[model samples]
Target chain A: MTALMIINMRNILSVIMLGGIYSLISAILFVVLDAVDVAFTEAAVGAGISTVLFLSAFAITGKHHDLKRRNHFPALLAVLVMGAGLMYSTLDMPAWGDAEAPVHQHVAPRYLEDSYAEVGVPNIVTSVLASYRGFDTLGEVTVVFTALIAVLLLLGAIREDEDQS
Target chain B: MKKNPILRETSHVLIPVILLFALYVQFHGDYGPGGGFQAGVIFASGIILYVLLHGIKKTEKIISLQTTKLLAALGLLIYCAVGVAGMLLGGLFLEYNVLAADPVAGQHWGILFIELGVGITVASVILAVFYAFAKFEK
Candidate 1:
């Protein structure tokens, strides 16, 4: 019982500390990649909002585990089968960050070089998003708006009821 | 009514500057790091500050719900119009070069129009969403 308690404490500490550390690192990485917009979003959503949301969820649902007997046989089998197929396919993938790879040689260069001349944006990513691939940005904005609407719908009715009381 | 003239004056004064900056960013996107999305957020932030300091009702008076909704729809329409212009000029949907007689300048104009559309849409939608959330909240 004592060992299990110690292990659980360690796990909780590691989860909190490691999650914070990784989030910080990822935020810096985003900055380094010149994705200030994405970096702002990551810092806001991941570091601030997500941490608070997780804590709130934990408060609503107690820390204690229910210890349900999760039937994992089918899940395990499926994962294993998928893992084997993935491993087989890995042979075809170009090595990570290979400069000579087709991905590096293709239209990506044109987007980077021509983005300024064509789109007139200093930030190539922004140019790609707002100009070159604006349709995708429009779709993404719609998705975010839809999500906001859905959340409002879920919580809005409760506010009205409480006001009536 | 507890009258605070300073906060009201400051925000009212700041709104025009913020909106102007948003316009500059929207148009000047081709040359700088600031673009439609960033400009939209910045513009929305100014309005949000007004809403924060003053009541939602006061903010609503300045930008009505109907107006915001119309602006959001208008932004999308502007984007579609640019696309249609490109198509009519014998280019693909959203193709910039075919937008004008000079293909290169046409691309520039096309991008500028598209960015403006994006900026307007994003700003209005964000403000509208904020309004939807804050309006009914006690």
Candidate 2:
């Protein structure tokens, strides 16, 4: 498995590359699920930009991690328990793409039916996010701006000296 | 690597194509799967590709870090301004119905502007973060 390879690799660069590969595969899986927008986002953000960032960070830090053999039992046990718990929780969920599912019975129908009449956009996703749910999109933009500020502060890139005021 | 003719020539061919694709993804979202977020990441990836090939300093000369930082804030401003504009037009905050003569037209305009704002912020922020990472000295 890609996750296994990524975890086992001592070379940090290889691990980072493998992480990108894992995300790329996940993006493809999204495409298979017909979540094309999500697939595009995952491919670009997860596989593309993040991989470059990882590589840049790798350039700053040295090549490889310490390769000391460590006991994996505790980590393995934790992972198994978490996976089992998650799988057990999914047992109570509705079948995949079931029309009678609570999610389908919710506001999805209204969005699918009336969004075109109201928003006039062929893409219901766009209408839902940008028109019907405009406030959320604004919040998302604010979050992106906040993230930039946080990264700049953390990286010492926030210069306070020079100002035109 | 910058001097290598193959890499240089290939980049010349690819960069514009990448940028064009980003634009397509942005404007075609009404009819397609992509929108602002994906388009922004694609745009940033193009810039990152240029940085990877050409040196960072050279790339920064074209689009400075200060500009990107400003643009990131500008994106959020644009989004808020749209919401405020909607409120001023006799509607609730972020209400697109009052944006134009027709409610549908107003929605279209609102979505377009917000997507543009989202695209700008996402692209600039990602690029700015990459610049930070690149500039950090061990």
TM-score list, all predictions = 0.64, 0.95
DockQ of each candidate relative to the true complex: 0.18, 0.83
| Ten contiguous residues minimizing lDDT sum, candidate 2 chain A | A156-165
Q: lDDT of model 1 at residue A71?
A: 85
For candidate 2, state the interface root-mean-square deviation in angstroms to 1 decimal. Answer: 1.2
Q: Highest TM-score, which number?
A: 2
Tens digits of lDDT, candidate 1, B2-118: 278887788779978977876776666666656666677667766776776787788777897557767767777788888888888788887877877776678678777777776
Off by over 4 Å in 1: A1-28, A40-103, A116-122, A144-165, B1-17
* RMSD of each predicted structure: 7.4, 1.9
Query: Candidate 2 residues A77-150, lDDT tens each?
Result: 99999999999999999999888999988899999999989889998888888887887888888888888889
Poorest stretch of ten by lDDT in candidate 2 chain B: B129-138
Model 1 chain B: which ten-residue window has the lowest total lDDT?
B129-138
Q: Could you tell me the fnat of model 1?
A: 0.21
- C-alpha displacement of B46 in model 1, angstroms? 0.8
Backbone clashes, each candidate: 2, 0
